[model samples]
Target: MNWTLEVVVVPVSDVDRAKEFYAGRLGFAVDHDTDLGGAGRIVQLTPPGSGCSIVLGRGVVPEMPPGSLKGLQLVVADLEKARAELVERGAEVSEIQVVGQNPRPVPHPLDNVGFVFFRDPDGNEWAVQQISARG
Candidate 1:
């Protein structure tokens, strides 16, 4: 059986704020924003070139706390470029650093070791890693 991951549910405190951050700052495409009346709101966004999308809803998963989601990673060809773009879009991102090495002013001397980090409006941490190539 072939199982393809479709969506990940991101928990956020405010729906509109989270939507704006994802769609506006991060430049994610808004797939849908639907209201189910008593069922609450469902908003889905798709990252560029990603088969898996992300969803956050008012009544979806109440147990998960907003800003608690961590270690979400996005792979990029260039960590510097990705971090620069996100910073230009008004997102505060960390400088490129080695993932599994000691902190330094400028790490990632090795290829495929570059990484940057940032967070959503709800404080959901995201890591952007630089890979020399991807298949």
Candidate 2:
């Protein structure tokens, strides 16, 4: 048996607004926007090259305070490029911060140490880390 995280349900106040933020601003691909016909609506979006998808819904998902989710992380090959792309996409991402000591030095000192953070419209926090090569 294999355990894989295929989806994460993100709590949001407005499904449409969240959809726009994830799909329009963050550049996540909209997988589907389905209406359940009096039950609720479900919108799924996936990041580029990511197998896991995020779900934002109204009346069809778990109940949690909007913006309560935090510390969701993403790994990238280049922190600087990823930050730049996020900024270009209109997301207010934090400056790249090098935290902790690098176990092994890579071509870029920031590799394995560099990180950037941002929040969605509902304040769900996400961290992006640079990991060009994994040991």
The C-alpha lDDT values of all candidates are: 0.84, 0.93
- Which residue pairs clash within candidate 2? none
Please, what are the lDDT tens digits per residue for candidate 1 over residues 15-111?
9999999999999999999998997999999988888899988985565989998988888776777888999999999988875763443333634
lDDT by residue (1-135, candidate 2, tens digit) is 999999999999999999999999988999999999999999999999899999999898999999999988888998999999999999999999999997676888888899999999989999999988877
Q: Which candidate leads the pack in TM-score? A: 2
- Candidate 2 contains a number of clashing pairs equal to 0
Instruction: Go through the candidates in order and give the C-alpha RMSD of each one to the true structure.
Output: 4.1, 1.0
